[model samples]
Target: MKRFLAFVKKEFFHILRDRRTLLILFGMPLAMVLLFGFALTNEIKNAKIAVLDLDHGPHSRQITDRLLSSGYFQLIQNLNASRDIEPAFRRGKVKLVVVFPPNFSQDFARNDTEAQVQLLADASEQNTAISLTNYATNIIQNYKSEQAPPGTVAPMQIDVQPRMVFNPELRGAFVFVPGVMAMVLLLVSALMTSVTIAREKEMGTMEVLMVSPLSQLQILFGKVLPYLLLSFINGCVIIALGVFLLGIPLNGSLLLLLAETLLFTFLSLSLGLLISTIADTQLVAMFASLLVLLMPTIFLSGFIFPIESMPRFLQFVSNIIPAKYFIEIVKGIMIKGIGLDLLWKPTLLLLGMSAFLMAVSLRNLKPRLNQ
Candidate 1:
């Protein structure tokens, strides 16, 4: 019993001395709990909205005030013309737009059927669109009931015509396809590259490669290029399956989508190379890939949960996640059919992240190559 206790004590001390082991054992649970606790939720809040109150009457103003004050939405734009609606959605500025037609208050007071409100929603994310329409409808209903004269049946009706844009049917596949593409491409590219390089280092063959005529950049590229080609092929296959089998539309330019996919795959590979520089073993590299890449892609990338619904700090943290930008780019192209004119921001961000990651990886790899 004493010898067994001593062995247990020694193992505990060994774990304490190994920082990576300690982090995996203690830090990961805490991080996962905090992230999942805040990030995973169905409720939506502070959703961006636009208002086109053509009526510009008291009731129109009142409903608009109620919506903003209800704490469920934030007004990002007050559109001036009907033509502005498409530009608002294409810019990703607002998720829902509340448009009160001309003479809205007068028609409602007269109990005319023309007292209608149109809700234009971006249904690329199905659940959010439904939730926003529901909330807006409820608010309008409450206003109608309260405005009715006492001891009388409700005399006014405000028809809410919720028109879902981009995806009128609100299919779940529209949302998940982009998310799955991001997650799969990132995992295949980063995990494979990290593991391959870690294996070479573990087997001592990396030393042999370092001594070869190939330069450090060439050595690293040679090790990773095959995986890059494989990842790109895998991305293309995923897109083909999504379009043909799942019935997800490829509405945007195929050439542009392919180009963006290649960029994202390269970014993921750069991240993997960066991970390999930090992890000396295959197990560590794999763990780092999952810990650093997979979880963030799933949670922080706004893949499953709406980022606006998460806590403020987590939303800020999500800005740094490459998958967040890539997923947006994919959805924008495939669902909204928007071109690079509107997508330049996310595309530039992906390029910047790729460049940064590659620079750091090359810097870290230089000393190892020399040794």
Candidate 2:
């Protein structure tokens, strides 16, 4: 017990002594959560569009007014002909181009309407285009319904109700906040440890420690244990940021959140140890960590993009990325309020991955010394 206490004390000293690592371990998670929560989102807003109102009547004007008032599309240009829309879109000045047909209001008033408006959207902006198209369709459909004569459509209608599932708000931030935590923590902690270890080699302290009487496990723990604590604290920092700074709710069990957080911390540290084992230089370790860990964790982890919708090969590849499992665990706990009973599969995968990384790292680690 005394020796264990001494070991833990040394571990704390190792972490607190390094100002750079301390700042990153505590600061990066908070920074990333805020950035993702505030700056980045799946929902596109205030999208700019150009209009070619050819009808030149109440119908076209009403359509323009609807698009302008919907808040999804912003009308930036008003052109007289449909031909000008091509150049505007070609020059990338607008995301959508609306063309209202001729005599649309006259046709409507005569009850001989066969009017249609063309919505030409930039397919390059796929997600934004889809959202705008959907909004336009819904608005047009509502307008058509309103155009129906009184009593032609039911005065009042009874409808079956549909309520939201786990996330009623559909805020998207609820999903991203937890995911960004997993991603940023993995990047910051894993890169920090790997690069720090490689730097020790560059500076020759690794040799000095090797020559000492410290066991390999002690030396390993002396490095990673501190990062583990820092990572755990960083988890707390992110939770606080999400709850207070971002106003993201923690709807599930705190104990579950902590348990999953510690698991994720170990998972990332294990990957860091593996990276340190493979690379002798800090630069290589950093590049490898960023390329291998940071990008995939954000892109492939079902954090922002749905894994099921990805290509089959990508779905297979994402399964091996430990960040995926951790993100699922944290998101499940924080956003979905899911308990361990429902999350055992991902939890086991993370634990297994950590165990595998430890074995591989220890095996790669020179019991005597690195040449």
Candidate 3:
């Protein structure tokens, strides 16, 4: 009994001394709790919307004000013309557009006529579009009810016409296909590259490469190029399956889509190379890829959950996630059919990230190779 107690005490000390063990035991659980608690909710808030009031009357303005004050929606644009609506959605900030027809207040005041308000929703994100439209409809109905005079037999009726753009069917495939592509490409590329490099290091073959005629940069590129090509092919396969099998529309330029996929694959490979420099063993490389790459790609990329619904801190953390940008690019190209004009920002961000990661990986790798 005494020997067992001593052994247990020694084990406790060993656990206390190992920071990685401590993180796995305590930090991982805490992170899981926080991520699940904050990121798993279906509720959305401060969803961006546009209001187009042709009437410019008090009733239309009041409904718009009520919507803005409901805390569920933030008005990002007050559209001037009917033509501006599609452009508003393509820019991607406006999720729902509330268009009030001419004589909105006049119609509301008349007992016989129905007041019409059209809601144009960017349904690329089906769940969010549904939620925003529902919220707007309810708000408009509440306002209509309040405007009723006491003892009047009937109040003016509000007809909220909701039109879903890009994806009227609200197919689940539309949302998941882009997200799945991002997750699969990033995981496969980063995981395989890291494990391959780490295996070479662990097996002592990296030393042989260091002594070879090739430079460190050449060795790194040689290691990564095959995986980059393979992951790009994997991305293409996912896209094809989504289009042919799942019936997802490939609305944008296929060449541009392929180019962007290549960029994202290279980015993932660079991340893996960076991880390999830090991890001396294949096990550590695999674990690191799962931890740093997989979790954020799943949760924070607006893949499954709406990022706007998360806490401010988590939303801020999501900005740095590479998968978030890639998913946005895929959705833009595949669903919205928007080209480089609107997609330049996320594309540039991916490019910058790839360059930075590749530069750092090579810089860190060269010193290790020499040593």
Local lDDT at 281 for model 1? 96
Give the lDDT of residue 290 in candidate 2: 77
Model 3 agreement with the true structure over 3-46: per-residue lDDT tens digits? 99999999999999977668768876898898887666778888
Q: What lDDT tens digits, residue by residue, belong to model 2 across residues 251-365?
A: 7798988988888898888889888887777977887787678877876776765453454566688899887877767766665566787788888988899899888877887
Ten residues in sequence with the least summed lDDT for candidate 2: 154-163
- TM-score, candidate 1, is 0.97
lDDT of each: 0.91, 0.72, 0.90
By TM-score, the best candidate is 1
Determine which window of 10 residues in candidate 1 has minimal summed lDDT. 34-43
Query: What is the per-residue lDDT of model 1 for residues 154-247, given as tens digits with 9 covering 90 to 100?
Result: 9798888999999998889999998999988888999999999989988999999888898877889998899889989988998998899988
Answer with 2 or 3, whichever has the higher lDDT.
3
Q: List TM-score per model, in order.
A: 0.97, 0.58, 0.95
Model 2 misplacement above 4 A? 1-162
Clashes of each: 0, 0, 0
Query: Which RMSD values do the candidates have, in order?
Result: 1.3, 15.9, 1.7
